[model samples]
Target: MHLSLVTSVLLTFAVFWNQIEYQQLIGSWQLTHFEGMEKIVNSSQYQNASAAEKAGMDARINYRLENTVYQFEEGDLLKFTDLENQTVVQKEAKIEIKEGNMLLIHEERGDRLAKIVEFSDDKMVLQPISKNSVSGKLIFERIKK
Candidate 1:
């Protein structure tokens, strides 16, 4: 009886751990700079810009992670709509899960861009990478409802 009880406890713990890990990625997040407490906000120019202009603006604004709407879809994919124009940016690429984090890689023309996602209790950071260098960083916070 004691052996059965111990096995049940261990199994329960394992299940709980898995559940928590999954939940960690199942909410809203914001991107902010690593140096300061400033929350990255989208600018107005993106809203009125053309597609080409919007593409250029991509490197300037931060991003928000919407994990609740799209979960477990491939490529560790999360929805990130541009805050200024409300356009979906990373919808085409496949997202991947690495270690305990999420990654999104997309190709535009010949340039390859990557987004490294990191999350905490209240915020998430989306750092954009190009040519193996960080182009910009976006910090997002959970939207309370």
Candidate 2:
């Protein structure tokens, strides 16, 4: 009986803790910078690539850094928007925070998960949780509270 009661208490505490962390994410954030792109760009593969291929890669990365906005709304709703073109990249997406640090975005295409490397009042850093992710840590700044 004592062990069961202790487990229940811990579970409740964990859920409560996660809720607090999720609350902080309820706002509009813009992607300002990212790491690891340089590593990929400097790699031998990128160096050997054709000029057109290199330009494509650079364009994609620039688009994301300058135009991506992730709005985390109430009820776990996430809206990914492209500010440059004023279009919604993904609508009706759901987000969940696990273990108070792992962020999972459930989209129609696939789930994108990231680890919260650092978070503050206006700045957040996310490290993509993927074996194939080479973008490294993404830095976001809160645009709307």
Candidate 3:
């Protein structure tokens, strides 16, 4: 009986670890990397594009990925910075986590960015589920002030 109780406790901790990870996100996180993204952006077609088109793509990519930061606060308040140190993407958002530790940003908008592939106190990685396209990944690391 004692052994069974101990086992149950350990199992509980394992499940709750994801919740603890979410708590750790109540701070600033900077975009660090995106898994499989380089393959898409640096593909032959992208490289063969005209210089002007390349510049346009570069601008969109930078705004979405490079130097982008997110601040998550208590009560599900979130601030997104599409371009670092510039205009704010959104001043507020209500976030939530559904089954499988899916991070739902702007819940009211019905945006489902599912299956946070990996999460830790210092790092977070997310990959959105898509039916047609191969959705890439997003990685963020906690930014210390």
Candidate 4:
């Protein structure tokens, strides 16, 4: 009985903790790094790649370019900015927590499950699953309250 009570309390605590963490994401975040694409683009392997492969890689990299910012609004609306094209795309998404460490973002584009590698008030590191099932790391810093 004692162990059961302790387990119940722990579950409750975790729920509250996750609520706070989820709320923190309801703000602006700017992309600071994309190690996955950057490493491939800068490495010697890129030089040997065929033109088509290069183009495909470039297109994927384009979506996660530096200076990109994402604003998560209160009503599940996400405003994403692409600095290179100076374009802003808005989509409604539902954020769901999967297994405590992953966040599932369901939107018009598709459902994306991102692993939270590191998260704090000022910074976040997420690894989102790409179209080809490849995972890409994205680092971001808070830009607005």
Best by lDDT: 2
Every model: Cα RMSD to truth: 10.8, 5.5, 4.6, 5.4
TM-score of each: 0.40, 0.67, 0.67, 0.63
Rank by TM-score, highest first. Answer: 3, 2, 4, 1
TM-score for candidate 4: 0.63
Task: Give the lDDT ranking, best first.
Answer: 2, 4, 3, 1
Local accuracy of candidate 1 as per-residue lDDT tens digits, 7-111:
999988865554324446555454444422122224455567788887654454333333212322333445543433555543433444443343544424443
* Model 2 lDDT, residue 40, Cα: 69
What are the lDDT figures for the candidates, one per model? 0.48, 0.81, 0.74, 0.75
Tell me which residue pairs clash in candidate 3: none
Q: Which segments of candidate 3 are over 4 A away from where they belong?
A: 1-13, 16-21, 49-60, 83-88, 130-133
Model 1, poorest ten-residue lDDT window?
A: 63-72
Residue-level lDDT tens digits of model 4 in 1-145: 9999999999988866754356778888988778776678887878788999889878766766654787877765666764435455444577766665687888676787888878889998888866787766889999864
Clashes in candidate 2: how many? Answer: 0
Q: Please give, for residues 1-145, the per-residue lDDT of candidate 2 as tens digits.
A: 9999999999999767544367888888999887867776999988999999999888877876777788888899988865436443546688988875889989787998988878888998998888785557989999964
**What C-alpha root-mean-square deviation, in Å, does candidate 3 show against the real structure?**
4.6
In model 2, the runs with Cα more than 4 Å from the true position are 1-20, 44-60, 82-88, 133-135
- In model 1, the Cα lDDT at residue 44 comes to 55
